[model samples]
Target: MQSTLERASHWLALLCKIVAGIALLALLGVTIADVSTRYLYRLTEGAIALRVIGSVELVSYLMLLSLLAAMAANVEKSQVVVEAFSHGLSPNLKNRLHGVYLLGFAALGLVLFIGLLDSATAAARHGEVTQDLRLPMGPIYYMAAVLSLLLGLRSLIHALLSAVFGAEGEVSHGE
Candidate 1:
């Protein structure tokens, strides 16, 4: 059962990374397009209005959202953590520390998720909209909430499994 759960977590983590990679590429493409369009064009009044009112606003906001997704995925994988202590600890201790670290991370993710949801709700109440396109801000907030929940879940599963099985079993760290 522990092995199965660990395998499932690994698969889920892999899926998250793949999704993050795709989002990062989309963000890069949007950024390049935005920059290229700005540098190559001298638009008339109407065209300028359209650019300001359409693609620019959408692309910019979506790129930011996508980047956040990628960042959250990295955090979920513990890739963002410094590894200076790994070499000094026994594998079992290292694994237990990892579990504690993940639990802390999961708590943080939950806090952020709640904060974002509150902010989004407030924005929605105030009818907040994007500057140029006037797109609703609530959806972006909800997206952030979704990403945060995913990270929280990832951390939680790892932490719980590590705590319960640390004595008899452990997740492989390539050690």
Candidate 2:
């Protein structure tokens, strides 16, 4: 069971990376296209108008936000340090500290997750959009909210598992 869960988490993490990469690629393409078109227009029309280009830019910006969220999910995993006193501390204390860290992460994630959902709903109802595109911003907000919620759930699950099993290296006290 544990192995399965670990495998699933690893796959999900990989999926996030792939998604981030795709979003970044799309952003780059849009940016290049927008710039080239504007440059050509400026040479011919005597001034650059970025209306359509700006719409693309808005999408690009949203993509950037998505990419950052994905990257954070992955980078934060390894960067999460619970080792305030790992080497010199007893095994049990170290495990407890790790559990505490996991719980903290879960709490943070929960807060962000709930707030994001509400924000997304409000944005949708308001028909919010970027000034250039006038495209609905609700979808982007929704995606972000979902991603954050998943991250939170993942952290919470990890916390529970660690608490039950102790650190990876030590024998679990209960079982």
Candidate 3:
């Protein structure tokens, strides 16, 4: 069961990384296009009207998605650590402490997932839409909720692994 879960988590992290990459690429593309169009319009002195409508809305949504999609992978690999504080601790103790820290991230993810779900429901009920693009807000909230749930599950799994298996490939700080 543990191995299966680990495999699943690995695949989940891969999927999330791919999604984050694509979203970031799209965000970059949108920003470039928006800026290019504006620059061209100015350079042409009103002869070219190539402004991208609702670019701000697109960028904001894409940024949110990219960040959220990266959360599952980041939960395991990109945690902030004060190595100075844990430098003297034994491996076992460090692993246990890391497990607790991961649990905090799990709790945060779970809470955000629940809140996003509620927001999705409310948006659907009220027919809420984006200000500029008029895109339905419910689906976006649903996607965010799914990503948050993945983060929570991945964090829980890592927490268990750290607590029970003594941190995987952990590096000593002062070594």
In terms of TM-score, which candidate is strongest? 3
lDDT of 2 at 138: 81
Best by lDDT: 3
User: Which residue pairs of candidate 1 clash?
Assistant: none
Tens-place lDDT digits, model 3, residues 11-44: 7887889888988999999999999999999999
lDDT by residue (tens digit), candidate 2, 1-175: 6555455555656666776777777777777777777788877795765534574556666585665458435522533444654668876666556656767666766787688789789989988887776767788777777666656665655565556655442222232
Q: What does candidate 1 score on TM?
A: 0.72
lDDT of 1 by residue, 46-79 (tens): 3653232365666666665665556455543463
Superposing all C-alpha atoms, what RMSD in Å does each candidate have to the true structure?
A: 4.5, 5.5, 3.7
Model 3 regions lying over 4 Å from their true place: 169-175
Off by over 4 Å in 2: 35-52, 55-60, 71-76, 80-84, 90-96, 167-175
Each model's lDDT: 0.67, 0.62, 0.84
Instruction: Locate the minimum summed-lDDT window of 10 residues in model 3.
Output: 166-175
Q: Higher TM-score: candidate 1 or 3?
A: 3
